[model samples]
Target: MPSNDNTPRADRQELAYLPVPFPKAPPKEPRFAALRTWWQEAWEEDGVLRAMWEDVLSAPEDGFRYMAPWLRAVLMVAGVSFIVLMAKAAGEVVLEGLHQLLTAVPKVQVGGDTSSGVFAVVDQPVRTYIAQHSAGLPVAASTVYTLWLLTGITGLVLGYLSRNNGVRAMWAGWGAASVFMVWTATPATSRPIAVGLAVLAWTVLSAFAMRGLTLRRRVGRPARPARVSVKPEIHVHVPAPAPAPVVEQHPHSGCPFRD
Candidate 1:
């Protein structure tokens, strides 16, 4: 269309340097709306959070009992070790070649000294294959072993910290230990008794651990600070009492009206 103005149509053309508004953006939802909704839902009369809060409030505090503490401690230690061994066995099968592949990388080194001890016998055949098959990849047997040991210790500590209850802690410790064990163990017939014990321990401990983790997350969480609600107080003032309702002078006598 030709411009009605005197200026040239090119000069009159409006330049859109700024970004064009994008379809009004569908009115983005407020970020905290979801949080607020969740809070309201969780606080409902029959809600899970509400029930948990009630249970905690009503539950009686009990004194700690040291029943079979020695036995329990020994069991937990054994359970964790067993879980780690099982993890190693599983890793050997699943990781197969990748396990050795990791050894080629210096960072994946299990230990610094690999000449003797568990490292020597475990994965001896696979270790040879890793060396011969690779293209000059330096392998440190001890490094891998050390890494596995560190992982197990770390997991054991974390598992202990996760649960306050002794029974739950035992399970949690075993479950965590299994995770670290994957890096260290090789499939072997040695320590069959220990292996059998591990299988039993893992079955029992892991089952309990799963339940504790899934259902008792709130139980382990730190107590939330009580909400301090501040209600606004309203104050109203009536102007100076309107001169106290003036009494009219009585024409009959000296008495003034009392009503």
Candidate 2:
């Protein structure tokens, strides 16, 4: 038992400091932390391919902008164009394919009449109206293909120059495919306007893709540190002026002049 100051002296006791347990080791990061980080980063990003897929699935910040336009201008224009082009291309492709195919393989028809076919063929008034203007085609497609040599070459060169192997491979493959497609389809395009339309679509799509990539590149990159300019310090030697002497005066009762 300890005694108070007014009581008898007590035995001295050793002072002890607080015992703090070491901080628990920070939780171990998961083995696939890098993958998890990448997934987190990529999931939120509006990548061009991902955005396109989202658009297709009708999944995005806005489900489909085309559906809810206040003016409905784009929707109307697209609808009209879709109807017109569908009607025209439907007949044009069939007639042109049949016309070209018959010229190429006249015996593909069962009898003198072009009604029945050894292969699938459009029948009747279609065959009668258009025969001399076109010959039967082997392929049945109204596809238009156009490739810009400059664009493909530039993409290939840039891809090769890029640090990423995946990007390099992508551009290389795309360029080769574009060349092949344009080569094969250009000759087969029955209409003169198809080539022009193909060029326009190709340009427009490329512009959109470039715009998206440019935006991503700008947004994803880390900001650079701001530079600070340092100016040289100059020392001036202006001397302080000397203090003026102080005069003391006292007034005497009879000697005011002398004081």
TM-score for each predicted model, relative to the true structure: 0.23, 0.18
Model 1 Cα lDDT, one tens digit per residue, 86-192? 99999888787666645654654332234464434433433433333344445454444444444444544544556446646554554445432422343455445
lDDT value, candidate 1, whole model: 0.54
Error of 1 at 105 (Å): 16
lDDT of 2 by residue, 48-130 (tens): 44554555455345544553353245557889999999999999999997576445543343212534442112122123223
Query: Residue 144's C-alpha lDDT in candidate 2?
Result: 10
